[model samples]
Target: MTSFEELGLSAATLKAIAELGYEEPTPIQARTIRRMLDGADVIAQAQTGTGKTAAFALPIIERLDTRSHHPQALVLTPTRELAVQVAEAFQAYGKYHQIAILPVYGGQPIERQLRALSRGVQVVVGTPGRLLDHIRRGTLALDQVRTVVLDEADEMLDMGFIEDIEAILQETPSERQTALFSATMPQPIVDLARRYLRDPERIIVQTEQMTVPQIRQVYYEVGGRDKFEVLARVLDYESPSSAIIFCRTKSEVDALGQRLTARAFPAETLHGDMTQVQRDRVMARFRSGQAELLVATDVAARGLDVEHVSHVINYDIPLDPEIYVHRIGRTGRAGRSGTAITLVTPRERRLLKLIERSTGAPIQRLRVPTIADVIARRRESFKETLRETIAAGGLEPYVSIAEDLGEEYSPTDLAAAAFKLLLGEPPEDAEDLLAEQEPDTTEEEGGRRPRRRREQSFGPERGMTRLYLDVGRNDGVRPADIVGAIANEANIPGRAVGAIELFEHFSFVEVPSNLAERVVRALKRTTIRGRPIAPSLARPRRATGGARSGERR
Candidate 1:
């Protein structure tokens, strides 16, 4: 409701924001920025896409003393990805200030981070796990830190970093200004605030009042490998008037869009990576109906309220629940029921539960459409096209052509041929039109698949190292709980992790030999599944449960 300049932001910060083409301050920004500039400690209730990063980043950069190189601000995030994103925002807005910001997180080589720390920077944004490591190494100095932000505080709590967060807060100067933003203010978070923060201002941003009623919502639990296949079926069977598929990241949007187009779907992509002119061209075709399918990232799709959107397919489940609400709400506008289908990978079941709980809407599980269903839908569409033509009675001009074909071929054969022509199948490949169904692939018949960037194999095998976890299945810990924590903590890709065996008393997981040491150190510093993970190179000398020789039962 307020203008950006009215929030007391520096001229350079305002200039950069204006150049980004934003004028009005979002509800969260309007309330939070004014208080932050007023030197108030604040706790804000806002989601990922609600412009919280800018609300904090703008004020942090505005108050930055560019002449002083030491980090005056510390922004702690839940994930490395978020740290990178927030750091980028600081660097962008501070270009005019000539201020430098650095992001430190695990998985990234620490030497580089230490070097950056050695050459002091103006702002430091990092994850607690890695930030703690830096602090322990005596490379980062926060004695002079003026502003500290705990971004995504609830996520940090969920990630079991509450203790580390508290310790990090203790390390910063007590006089330092603190700003906290989270969607949910759980008891643990409130307790954290009460313990450390001065009387902080509170700002809340609620969901938008209106929704696109025309869009129908449906969800299906799926795996990562099967999403593309399912999405192809949705497009093939539904044949939306013009569809826009939303992905969470620019990389995903490009990859998914390219994959769909390679399979002969008339699709194009739009994302932050694209130039403004390229975006203009893609939208021009979409608005004019030439581009039947558009794959876009969330940044590219913001403010898109297209009336003719028949279906909005979420190929990659968004990380945030509100983003899900926004993605599906893209369709079913103007009082017409449109279809919104989301594909959730098994690992993202956590996100599914959160969305259902937050939106207060039941996410009906949908069954995957089989090949037969796809064919049925395609035939039904073809029949409607034929029937509509017949009812309109405008085919008299084509009667001669049909009569001539009927003389050489039976009416059934001619009709089948006509169906093939209408659907854009080649004449030679069209014989026996209703051929047995086989899974369609991105590979063209007789053509090679695009050579994917060969992910340097970790090799056919590698040394295996084991760790002793204090708890297992009995402690509400699953393989994923172990994997997500380590994958996030060690900065290891989930796919890189190997065998896991859990038992009543403890669990042991095999990780790549090279990262075994760091993984052990990280696990030792944190708890897994609410129980401390006492990881050591040597396995637990004694058996605690019924288990196999190599794995815990």
Candidate 2:
């Protein structure tokens, strides 16, 4: 809870921090900034969205010799995207000071970088490969560099840039201060730190695991194709006063934002590709309530400080558990209750569990809001508006028209007609919302069950129903596949799938009776290892109360 000023930052840096609306330094920033300011070689383990960028950037910028046009500090990141992000952070924090920061990365014109290098920047943020390219060309000078930062060191190792990092470190002054920040310290990262850093102070920030308890975390297990529709359904059901939908990529942000706008959701998108002016405008609209929903990628959504955000929807789960924590942290701020909803695929169940363990909180499973649910919510909203209008007594002008209409028709009839008009066509049938699954039929085919055999029936267990799936052991199916498919498709928890009895060519899996139809419909449109499946209600067999052992192949 330390402020930047309290961390002994310069007045100019503190001003820039205030402008950015950051009042208190995050735990990582508080701990890392002081250590860096003291000129200590530090290795910090902190996740993205923990203010780690500012943690390193602020201290580096603070110590920059602005008079010298040479690069005083260098930051090595894992990707071009991260390089740009770090550079932007440095620029923002150093706006008042006469400091120049440049981001050099691949996919961008080398000439541009060369020109910037010639003009001389105080700091350079770049990826290893691109930085190494600059080093080879003698375009980027390292002799004057006094401090070096390896941001996301583990990620760099994962990308096979450890050797490049070593070469870069070797090129810098031996007396230069080094700081390495990573979410996890694998053995390779530890070894790199030991070799490069001298008597480094290890600082581990564990703030991400403590997400606000006021936030109601929930997730909808769903498929890729159905994600957007489910998002719309949840939005409709919740009717959040203000919401932010987090997507994983720029394309996803733009696509989802466009679709939401097309559906009249009052949304705007923010991504790294957007120009600064465009980003400002989008954020302005979002903060001013001109837009209700802001759809953005994680990088774009960073540093978002809005108090009225009532909901955060993970249109796509983040790559890391800590990023999930950061995304949800956007809401439930300013002592207000907020809802954080994630759309998790079945294959991603283990990841969700990891997030739960990391945050020390369980995310509840949420069913996709049905058509009926959406309709009821809309109706309630309209009714509330009507009641408020009546309470405000603003209908004095409309009373005359109402009286005239009432004279022509009974008051109840007129009110009913008005309500029908407000409701608007009753949200087309739920079956129409998606492909229809065949309904359960009790009628016998050939005076017996269609797929009946001598197999003992487990029947329905309490509030659960048995479903017969066509693909089983013969099709290379496993219990996990069935659980994953059903949980992901029907947007239910895998644990909610009751039991499984695998047979040679078919299998019977038990799912909550309430979700049986949804599970059926979801499974119908998908396949397990390229083999399509048909799920139907298992017919009853002659009473046998003993345990019905599964017929595994």
Q: Pick the lDDT winner.
A: 2
Residue range 1-553, candidate 2, lDDT tens digits: 5777889999999876664446578888888999999999999997665678888888898898888999999999998867866786787788899799999999888999999999999999999999999999999889999999999898899999999999999999999999999989999999998888999999987764555456899988765545665676687689888899987667778767755643346788887789999999989888888788898877677788999999999887764455677778898888999999998765466567757766778899967766556656878888899899889886788889899998789999989988877543442344553333211122221222222111112345678877777676779999999889988888998888877877556677888867776887798789997898866555443121112344532
Question: What is candidate 1's CA lDDT for residue 253?
Answer: 76
Question: Each prediction's Cα lDDT score?
Answer: 0.73, 0.77
Off by over 4 Å in 1: 10-23, 45-51, 66-69, 78-121, 152-163, 182-195, 202-214, 217-238, 244-306, 312-330, 340-380, 395-408, 420-553
Off by over 4 Å in 2: 1-3, 47-49, 205-208, 214-380, 383-553
Per-residue error (Å), model 2, residue 87: 1.9
Worst 10 residues of 1 by lDDT: 450-459
lDDT string for model 1 (377-436, tens) is 978988998899899997889999999888899999998888877664432323332342
Please tell me which predicted candidate would have the highest TM-score against the true structure. 1
Reference-based lDDT, residue 65, model 1: 86
Clashing residue pairs in all predictions, respectively, total 7, 0
